[model samples]
Target chain A: MGIIAAIDLGGTAIKGALFDGTGPLTKKNHPTEAKKGYGHVLQNIDQLIQRMADNKGIKVDEIRSVGVGVPAFMAEQGRRVVLAPNLGWSDVDFASDLAEQMQKPVFCNNDANLAALGEHWQGNGKDIENLLMVTIGTGIGSGLILNGELYQGKSGMAVEVGHMVIMAEGSHRCSCGRQGCVEALTAAPAIVREAKKLMDVPTDCLPDVNITEAKQVYQAAASGDKRALQVVEKAAYFLGVALANILNFYELDVIIIGGGVAQAGDILLNPLRRTVARETVFFQRRPTEILPGMLGNDAGVFGAARWAALGEAKKRG
Target chain B: MGIIAAIDLGGTAIKGALFDGTGPLTKKNHPTEAKKGYGHVLQNIDQLIQRMADNKGIKVDEIRSVGVGVPAFMAEQGRRVVLAPNLGWSDVDFASDLAEQMQKPVFCNNDANLAALGEHWQGNGKDIENLLMVTIGTGIGSGLILNGELYQGKSGMAVEVGHMVIMAEGSHRCSCGRQGCVEALTAAPAIVREAKKLMDVPTDCLPDVNITEAKQVYQAAASGDKRALQVVEKAAYFLGVALANILNFYELDVIIIGGGVAQAGDILLNPLRRTVARETVFFQRRPTEILPGMLGNDAGVFGAARWAALGEAKKRG
Candidate 1:
């Protein structure tokens, strides 16, 4: 009956958006200021949603629901955040806290899952029956939209595609304490690490831009550095293997690659697509296409708003 | 509203069962005689159903629906077999042919999915919201029962878990043209291959068995052959990795390990469980349990019968 408020609860920033039943009305980004403590983060989200609703000329209670996409492992249909290392949260009742803050029914889900939902609602994944949304940021994350719905497993932790190991011998170690995981090899940090490692070579191969972040690697590749391109290609190969493994099993309708590293465009995507095709079997039976996510930063908030609407309806029913 | 006939169309044998809505009435196994050609295989299925019906004092037309579980890649929601190398089937309209012969509605799915369905109907998977059943024999196969229903992806081919590579650097090659796949590293053939290589050692550590088959390896392990036990443990480790990967992502209620190799019981399961636990993360969040399949060979037929019951209803609607 009213507008829905959504928040993509990132570690450093919260991407907030307002949505009607149709599409996004407005979006705003605000600092999380997480060091101010848990209550402060909730107040930050509450303030963000309040500001979005204010911009839409709607009261907090007039908003249908407040939905949040947290960077955490959630359970209890996303009412709880089991662990969020960045936020230093463990087994917190996020939904209740947000609900109490806003005095509106709250809904929450994994940030990647919400991103997939966002794309399903307004981006490249619209009307796709089975879709996969892969987010390659500081850490690689993925979400499964199966049979036209988000497929959270029994514990609401399905589609851990980033952690799926593609190489057994590779030395890259993931934050999950595993080696050769997709996250270990393809995450933005991994790219930066690889660039850092390659820059130490006897021969000067890279275009120096003080390679502190993944963005510098893209910049180096933009300058047509062969070694930089090769680093990306190598990461793409491992990512391709992981994607193939996912596609071979999940057999989705399409996959949308999103997040910071994926923004490198054709350099990452062209090779990633080729690798997926090379590793996948029975392509003629069902061809699952790979594409870039269209929504950019707004995807998570859009997904969150949509989840609020759907979850609110489910609750009412 | 009549009795259902189910068939597990195996390469060498067809396991048939009669179900009266509630439980299995009787079961019969017959030679598939696949060498007799495709038509012969269909006829064998027809004759087996006819005999089973005659034994129950009913006409063929009395059956409500016939559901067959085939060991092949399926399309069109299991209406067609894309390929079955052992059965020499390729792009055949299996559902239509079976329906025409039996004079009843027909439903079909991958044999592995049917096994999972059977388990869901009457075994360890009963009432489970999400389940994964893995069959590891000639080649490893798997099925996902998600949200209390069989998850057949977009092309009716999901849960290709066996093809998920565990040891990327491993030398074993799978029939699907992939190296270090779960099938390559942990299938019965892989077990036998490992056993054979180790049997050639100077110490002669094997239990004096010919070791031409996976069963011999199990027998050797049973007779206190340390080499055979080690081979199984190694395979289990890879299987555990694959299982851990599946579990980490899918987060199912339970996992059922079935098929010829899985029958080795504690020797294989104990180590496999240990490995899964070791590789999996956030186990403290949701501890998924893995168990052995309870239905044995009857799982496929039971699953087929259940599919017939559900699919027949869906068709009517």
Candidate 2:
């Protein structure tokens, strides 16, 4: 059984897992510190892989391939990042650069796309063929899987469901320079922004809620706070509308909601399902199933490993 | 060496054409008079095919297959019309009845979808692989071809681009009960409706102008009529916004404009292109090539023929 190394590359940290054809056997984590520059991050990936290989008492050749899940639009084969705003990079040739240092084949794609793939392959949507895995963290993102294959549109930027305009002249401003996008109103900061505007809540109200994270809005909503509930409901409506638009557009069988916001569960799911059901035009038939992510935080790593294994399979085929 | 029969089933008339397995050779036109009942219409089709086959000294089987394009949603191997508001049909087994009468395998699909496929197979989009054929007629209809294959979504209702809501609180009401659909604002009647709303258009000022056809407005605009041009520009802007939304969503390579309103040509195309370029997010890198449809009115007949030919190929395969 060949070994596949999966890496979830983020701005603050890099998590690596070693899988022997079946599942993870050992894992490692390291700080990314993206502001330090691309070279430093690349160096960190190289050192982490070396340490993992040494711990298993195996040579570099013993590993079959390595897969990476990044937060960016991959043009094709995940060789270069077209534009990753979080990483503060443009057109970085991470695939070739990493292969040169690690001396192994590397497969890469957008982290959200990979998470979707991970969920489709090994999580809730295992029995389903067509679905979308939406990741809602600080920003909103999605990976579309159609006809049992990843639907990367022309130029590889197909499923921008997050930026899909929900309101024509909506008040919220999305980071992508578009107004009325679902992400503009539903993302983490948007929730906090809405909370601050709803009440003259002190700075301590926010700090006490999360201290270090923005996901606490869900917690407040879960705690039965009226303002927080309204904020979450607003996000749910936009998400539901966006999902309804998606359901209207694609006729998808299921949509798996992931990311930090999904932790609120019923606080978000009930309204979302009702809104989507009400908003959808063709409600006579089966409605799109909304489910929680089964893979959780490990989804990106698992998806990356799946990407590597599939690449190896394709090469042999 | 073989001839194929193509039929366009309309509420008012039934249009038929004979092709020598390549292009149209002879045409036969007759009234559908569907209110005369289903059996009469079936008999009409039988007589039409018999007359054409006898005139050419050919057996019906030598024609390969018969294709019927209906203005409705067809499914379950074209054995039924899933829904068609215009024809007042619901789950009617039109295809099977037609195939049984003709004693040959028959294929059926929505007329607009077939038109796009026809354009892709032999008309304007012949050279382009990823194309979106948008027809601006009685209603806005679209047929999408992606990666060289016709993309029908999970429930076979994909590519209903006309119903895509462009305006949230839009002033116009669509035929589908949706508010602010592109079809409600830019279709032929919509263009005419806007022309009627223009203030102080003395009845004699633009003699060619009327509130029935888009061509009247085009003629008026050509004669340097300000009111006519304004209406045309408004319709064109809405169309451009809709196209921009589609491009932002799908990243299609080519968009073929067809149907009655498309006759305005450059008057509509020029403003549409400018608006789309301005509204689209990735306008610089991913430019969608907008072009005029080549098949004109014959697109429906040819598309019907192609739809029929697919069944013929499958039987022989």
Candidate 3:
């Protein structure tokens, strides 16, 4: 039972952490420099893990294994990153490459899935046996923990709730070429797109600040800007419908909302909760508790470390 | 283990079967007489089970236990029929009541759930570890078998794919008081409703015979009736969308279509399959096999028998 190292590779940065079962010992971050290509990103991850190990005063040999969570689909039993639109990566043997360079066994999974495991292991969903975590950021992503285990479906593609169509004939188009998907309606980019539409319209209800991001829209809504309030309400309504659908399908113990858009807190959650209550088919019989995720951006790293530790234990068994 | 008895209580009749692990030894059917009240249905079920055992040349004492599948929600760990709109039953302790009268333990669960288990154990889903069975009848109902077990959500309410809203803000109203639910659009009653709407219009394409039943609509469609084809196509489209949503959420290995409407066979399945292929998120990567349920009406009885046998084995353990 040695220390575990974890890396969460995001579009902008690679976050690294060292853990020894109790909790994270040290954390560090390095620029992903994704645009510079996969080689540079791999090197950065290598350095990031080394720095995290050094910061924790641990030897490389003392670290049992490393787990990486990437914003991409993992293939070949998590030895490869098959696709990552954000990082422009495809079919990269990330786990094997990292293992070769770092001299430790490596495992990898979709970042969202790890976030769910992290939440179930030690965060908001610690006591939950089954849970769904939906992250509403640049694009919506979800992870499912079912029957006390992370359910990856038949091909590690389960819980793609974000692409579920809320509006069958919706006007908005998703990046996946689908129309009316939940991501198309309520992701951070969707909210920003809606707010930009409002900005172009002639209205005295416009916010004073330049509304460019989803956060600005939330801030304006909090300050009672009419246009911003309308935009947020629309996104919240769609998000609620999607959540209600998930609740109906999974009947999970709890649902954790995380990522950028969820930071609006009560302003977003209140309306979403109301919609879920109204939209859920048997709400009285199957009430689901919806809450905010506790670990925030660090959930992926914690989950990766936990996954690595679990994998190591399984190997021992 | 002794012989096992299973009863599938439908609105019209109670189907009973006796099994000795290998297969059913005898089968019998009795009028449910549901309109006479829950008491009459229970009495009829008892008589049916007695008849099944007697026909098999076995004494009631030889039967280890009875399992009942009802068109209702099983509550209190498969001991009570929480709700059955067709049977006009609510909160009936079906298991305990039957156990007391029959002098043997009795277990109960939703008929659809049993059908799924039956399919998994002996039918099309025998080889499947994760599967979804959607029964399209007067109303649509669904069952889920996940990780090789029946997945009843927190309170036996998971896989209510019937009430999943396929068309948000849709004009069709479901029996559950929801609009645009898959059941609202694709159930037998819904198809009949749509056909009637077309019949009300003055069109040369109208069927010569009155389309009062879903069967009539299918017959007309098979005979190249234009209006009926439109209605069936519309229902198939929505049903496809709902199935696609289920596939995306669960990433199940296979989907089995059962019940009355599925009797339309390829006329309904061909269009539905095409729509599902088009609507699913990653159909290319995760190809889900869609097929018809093999055991047909016998699935419920087989499922109930299997469930009882499993319960008896667990008790022995």
Candidate 4:
């Protein structure tokens, strides 16, 4: 085994890590400046990889491969990024470009999927055969590990749990132009949106803190603010319902929740667990454990590195 | 290849068939008399298998194995029926009992799962690698075939799509004590229930036909009854949402809808297709085909036989 460079491309920053089979040797980050366009982002990634290799005193040839996790819909063969709304990309062959530039093999996949894979490789889902990792942040993102392998559907678009409809005639609108989706109900933006509605209502139980962001709402709820608690409860309810739906549909061993909103801790987890237990089709018959993802933001980089290693191993075989 | 007996157990009837690799050699049915309890149902199944073997002039020794499909939560190895509400069964070792009685190796699984396997093996899903088969009958039942095999989760209870909650605060109550599950909104019983509600609303748009069954509602809707159309539209919307959710989560090649309500043909399929197309997260990027199941009720028996054959082959290997 040799060093592998892993990069996780995001809207704000690009996270990079150097790994050698066992674990990460070093990790670093650089501003994405996505506003500067895809070419700039690619150049930035190339520079970051070079910097990591130099810092580790490892020649470029010593690195077995490079892995990339991007916030995009990857093609089935992982040859290209089919779509990335935030990156403003479509059908970009990032893998080929990076591989050509670095003069090494490179593998790429959906960022969320990489995170789930990371969790499975070295985080919370290790030793678990089947699991679903859902990251609840600006939007809900999920990665499914079924039968100990990544389960990307026919078009490499499986595990879009956020856009799953939780309400048939729901009022909340998702950015995907759909209503009552899990994302529309439980995403950070949705929580903040609900808090904004509650702030206008005259209530003695309102938190003294000004509600501007989802974190503030969580803070207020943690402090026993009734209005904030209601908002959290509502979001937790929908999240729980969505989770129960997943449990019923997949029957996995564990469900790992990650991202910013999941940081609400017990405020979200307790209620979510309760709702999931209450709403699950047959709780007595089929029980699924729900837990928080252990790898935090580094999950993507770790997963990307592992993906590259696996791809290289497969190629060698 | 030796003859294999496949049995699909329903509340009122037990459908049986004999298969020898190529296709089902013969098919027959017998009264389940489930009201007479588990013993009677078992006897019925035994008698049915004996009758089929006799009709084919095959001795019991010529039958390689037996397969039974039941509406229950099957154990991981398909040894027992853990819980089947309709059959009033819990932790029943139906496979062992039947195998002992018939002196043949027996395999068991959920009826819907078998139907999905059947569809994949010989029905509409033939040659397809990943698919979901949803039977929209009195109660909605679904089976998922992922990566060309049945996807039974941790405890052999995966792919219970019918119990997936589609509404967070929905008024419709499912028999499983959940609110607004796919079954509660789209099952045949639910359609009939919604039609009855519309009939009492005092509208000239209501069809003159008695709204006692789901079939009547579909017929009225087909005949241009406005009230009936509205009910069907609502059910179709919910069904479409549920299907979309499955698509987003599983990312399958196709979704095959079967059973009584699916018989509504274009009245239901047309709207469902449109809704799925419109409400899907990224329609242009990922398109999933939705079609009606071809094997119909016989899908279960066919699948059961195939499952037994596969199990025997695996054992021999």
Candidate 3 is graded, for docking, as medium
Instruction: Name the regions of candidate 1 deviating beyond 4 angstroms.
Output: A1-5, A17-28, A46-65, A168-171, A197-205, A311-317, B1-4, B17-28, B50-65, B102-105, B202-210, B283-285, B315-317
Where is model 2 chain A poorest over a 10-residue stretch in terms of lDDT? A203-212
Kindly list the per-residue Cα lDDT of model 4 for residues B172-201, writing each as its tens digit: 888888899889998988888888877665
List, residue by residue over B2-72, the lDDT tens digit for candidate 3.
68888888988889889887888888899888899766777787788777777777788888899888887
- Model 1, span A41-105: residue lDDT tens: 99988888878878878777778788889998788778889888789899899899888888878
Q: Candidates' lDDT values, in order?
A: 0.84, 0.77, 0.82, 0.85
If the candidates were sorted by their lDDT against the true structure, best first, what order would they fall in? Answer: 4, 1, 3, 2
Candidate 4 — which residues are off by over 4 angstroms? Answer: A54-62, A201-209, A281-286, B20-25, B54-62, B200-209, B281-286
Weakest lDDT window of 10 consecutive positions for candidate 4 chain A: A201-210
RMSD of each: 3.2, 3.5, 2.7, 2.7
Better of 1 and 4 by TM-score: 4
Give the worst 10-residue stretch by lDDT in candidate 3 chain B.
B200-209
Ranked by TM-score from best down, the candidates are: 4, 3, 1, 2
> Residues A1-317, candidate 4, lDDT per residue (tens digit)?
58999999998889999998689988889899888987788889989988888888977778889999888867765677888888888888889888888888989998899999999999999989889999888988889998899888666764788888888799877887888989999999999888888876545555244556799889778878888889999998998888888777666788889888988889988888899888874744557788988999888998899889889889999
TM-score for the A chain of candidate 3: 0.94
TM-scores of all predicted structures: 0.89, 0.89, 0.92, 0.93
The digit string of per-residue lDDT tens for model 1 on B142-165 reads 889888889886667647888886
Q: Highest TM-score: which candidate?
A: 4
